[model samples]
Target: MKHPYTKLLANIIAYAASIILYALNAGGSINGLTILSITLATIASINLVRAITTITERKQQ
Candidate 1:
């Protein structure tokens, strides 16, 4: 029920990279990359939230 540190770290890096890419793309008027980065960040955020919730629920049980 414990959180996986490695997974968390990976997610953190992914999330950070996504944000940076998104911003860079947006600022530079790169439509395709901006959209892709946004999508990736959204997915990563959802997965991270889900993982945290699952770990919390398992601990409570």
Candidate 2:
């Protein structure tokens, strides 16, 4: 079962990662946006992992 939102999830992960890197490089303070971006990236990563697992399971079955 292929997930329809895979591209969206990838984009979200990329966006969050870029935001985190930009913040780190800019020598800015740790604010809400930074925290939010980290959280979003983590969640997106987890979802992507789950999607992969599900696809593999389906293939095996």
Candidate 3:
């Protein structure tokens, strides 16, 4: 989405889901599912940051 808030929300949700996965696998072994969530969360966070930066730059114009 172009809106920064939407990106931020998505990022938050992704992070929350990722954390949940980690919490679920908080024993000893790590699996692909947990790693996937974390990867998704990282991607979402990057997207969020990019959106926020662009949004601010647009506003500054």
Candidate 4:
């Protein structure tokens, strides 16, 4: 089955992977890429929460 938010889920996964990679590469240092990845991850997390809320609302109807 496919979910309406499949694309968003994929994007979130990609963002998470990049965040991990940036952290590993930085080796305890903060850089532009690390900051950017973190920002994106935060945005993606918000989107995911919205998506989950939408799904729950639909189920209640």
lDDT of 1: 0.73
lDDT of 2 at 29: 71
In model 2, where do residues sit more than 4 Å from their true spots? 1-21
Which residue pairs collide, candidate 4? none
lDDT of 4 by residue, 12-60 (tens): 7787777777697867787777778687778869877697968877997
Which sequence of candidate numbers ranks them by TM-score, best first? 3, 2, 1, 4
**Candidate 1 at residue 36, lDDT?**
81
Worst 10 residues of 1 by lDDT: 1-10
lDDT at residue 49 of model 1 (Cα atoms): 73
Q: For model 3, what is the error of residue 54's alpha carbon versus the real structure, in angstroms, after optimal superposition?
A: 0.3
lDDT of 2: 0.77
Per-residue error at 54 for model 1, in Å? 0.3
Q: Encode model 2's per-residue lDDT on 9-48: one tens digit a residue.
A: 7776787778788888886677887788688778877887
Tens digits of per-residue lDDT, candidate 3, 1-61, equal 4764775677677767768666577845657877676778678777777778788889889
State the C-alpha lDDT per candidate: 0.73, 0.77, 0.72, 0.77
Kindly give the number of clashing pairs for every candidate: 0, 0, 0, 0
Span of ten consecutive residues with least summed lDDT in model 3? 1-10
Q: Local error of candidate 2 at 39, Å?
A: 0.6
Candidate 2 minimal-lDDT segment of 10 residues: 1-10
Winner on TM-score (1 vs 2): 2
Largest TM-score belongs to which candidate? 3
By TM-score, the better pick of 2 and 4 is 2
